[model samples]
Target: MALLDFLRQKEFAEISALKNKLALLEKDIEIFREREDRLNHDILSLRNERDKLLKYKDVSDVDNEKERIIKELKDAKEELQKEELESKDNIEKLKKEAEELLEEIENKKKQVVELDNTILLQDYGMYSPVYDFADSEMYKDRLDAIRTEQKNMILYKTAATCSTNWTLNGSEAQGRVMTNQNIKQILRCFNDECDMLISKVKFNNATAFIEKIRKSYDALNKMNSKNAVSISYEYLELKVQELQLAYEYAQKKQEEKEEQRRIREQMREEARLQKEIEEARKDIEKEQKHYMNALLKLDKQLGECDEVEKEVLLEKKSEIERHLSDLDIAIKDIDYREANKRAGYVYIISNIGSFGENVYKIGMTRRLDPMERVDELGDASVPFKFDVHAMIFSDDAPTLETALHHAFENKKVNMINGRREFFNVTLEEIEEVVKANYDKTVEFVQIPQAEQYRESQKILKSLEIS
Candidate 1:
């Protein structure tokens, strides 16, 4: 039984061994199954890879795809390189443009500074040098000579002989005859001498030189005579006193003549106005008589006339009454004017300096002093005073004025306005018309005394030089 147990144990051991082997085989089979599953998955992955590889199995297709990828990558690389090169070139161009603009800005800044300096230089009188002659003896002598010559010229100019010409058989003698040409020549000479003196003086001395010349001129003028030359200042003073006395006497005589003339003119005007007033009264009386006669005739016819005839007579009577009333007013005005001695004057005056030649003002004034009226007209309305061509005292001055205006209607300066009594007629033409219309020999002064205007012009010219 023990032997049987040993054998059985051996058999059991074998069985156990077999069981262990079976277990090992089962674990190996599980492992092999898992590996088979993994192998199947790997086979599927390999088959997919093989299929994908099979698509490029043709060498030319594989080469074409590979080459296309490589060419795309190469083209992208080349484009990137080109872009990088172009970016580098753009950067360089921008840097160059920036540098040029900086240079241009610097140049414009320099020009602005230069312009400022130029303007500053000009304002300070650094453009040109002023002339100086203060240290030269020759220039001083020249200035002295100029001053003496200027003084002599002033003496000659202010001398009384300069006012009128001394003629010996229609030829001018050695007096300072102030014709326009002669005056212009004298001014030219004076200006030339002044320029010579001014040129020799320093800028600082210019004002003093002008002042001295002006003072010398005034002194010479004060010592000058109207009809004769004064040899020296002291002699001139005594002669001037004598001449002044004679001038006062002459002025008194002239005033007496004017007063006598005015008296004679007043007498004539009074007589003429009285006659006009008498004539006007006679006309008024005649008109009143006619109106009364007409009214009486109308009253006699009114009772026998038809309605229309009565109206006609009434209108005619009204018109005649109106005419008579007007005549009465006229007569009253004439009587008043005659009693008041308010005779009107028709004056012919011309300002040749202010209103060129051939322009004359024909105006009337009823002032007692007609010269006052003319002087008022010449006050400030014109730049110069007017010279009287004729002053006619008339009883019916408006009628005479109207006649003269009508005579020069074609020669009116302001043709559009009849009330503008200025005419472009010569003094001689006016004289002829006046002589033909009235029995009076009118004395007309053709020359204009533009002394103030000429002197003012000379002063203005000298001021311009200063």
Candidate 2:
């Protein structure tokens, strides 16, 4: 029995130990379960907060909201990309427009520059024509013609260069409207220059007239202006050529006129010489007839008269015979014919008050009475009446005149033309030359009978005193 009780006590101790271990395990289990419940609650709260923050009222709405938000973000990004592309295109368009505008501005500038250069070239080409001439009475008509032509040319050129239309009615019009202002200014300058040139063209002959025109035109050609005529070089050259041709024509016309005048003067001189020769021949024939008749009458008177009267008649007959011999010689020497004529008388005369001492006119006369020629010479042509120096008859009057002219050729007032008969010689010197040439005595009057001239001089002196 003792052995059985010891074994049971050991068993009871083992069972109590087992029950205490179980109780401890049960308490630990409760603690673990409480912790698990807290962890679960915290996790639910976090999930709810996440859904609300995502703009969803419930868990089912969370996924749809997320999808909508993501889609919205994607659409916004695409729209931003589209806007960026459009901005880039706009930038490119603006850049292109700016380049085009700049090119247009450059082209306009080039056109303006070109236009200015053209205007400058036009302004550089304005000019005028020239003329020249000489001064002389022979060119009087030619000078007048040239002056008229110059004026006409200037008017024409002015019109051409300025494009101004003029009429006799004092009306004006523009020819070309494009350059009207420039043309008007050019016309004003041209007219002013032409007026000045015309005023200065006071010439009496062709040469002087042409010279003045040439000088004036040269001055005009050198003139400059900001707005000048736009005449081409070819046109200007043609105008100058025309002007030269006109000048040449004027000169040729003047030369022809002078030649005609010279020919007329020569014809007149020849006619005068022939007429004088014929008259001289007739006078010689008349004198020969009268002397022969006187000789025959004197011979008959000598035979009928008494001794004293016969002697006087014989002397008269002898004188008549000598005159007849002289007449015969004169007639033969004259050898007058229709083809071969005789020369007349060579006369010397002077007007002392009008022409100083030693001044005499030696000339020929073909009149029947030589004194008639001297009287004719003393007419209204001279200031004073001429004094008769010598009236010398000669069969060869031209030869005698030539001899006298040669003797006083050195003393001639006009040396160029020997026809001018005035000579610086004394009356005594002329008488000696006449006596040496002719056998007959020549009567010379030393004093001038200036009746009209002296009276005029006296009147003039009284007027001066008054």
The per-model lDDT (C-alpha) reads 0.60, 0.58
Q: On a 0 to 1 TM-score scale, where does candidate 2 land against the true structure?
A: 0.37
In candidate 2, position 33 carries an lDDT of 51
lDDT of 2 by residue, 1-466 (tens): 2332453355455545545554554455455455545545554654555455556534574676676765665565455456555545654554565455455545433322111233434433232224444433434555456556545644565433632343324434433443465555544554453344334321122233333334334444445233344333333333333444444445456556766776785565446555654676678678878877887787778778799998888878788788878877766654552234445788888877777778999987654466766777777887677877677777777778788889888999876455678998877788787778664467877766666767887999999999
Q: Largest TM-score belongs to which candidate?
A: 2
- All models, RMSD in angstroms: 45.4, 45.4
| Model 1, residue 303: C-alpha shift (Å) | 79
Those runs of model 2 whose alpha carbons end farther than 4 Å from true positions after fitting are 1-211, 222-224, 228-323, 336-374, 388-466
Best by lDDT: 1
How much RMSD separates candidate 1 from the native structure? 45.4
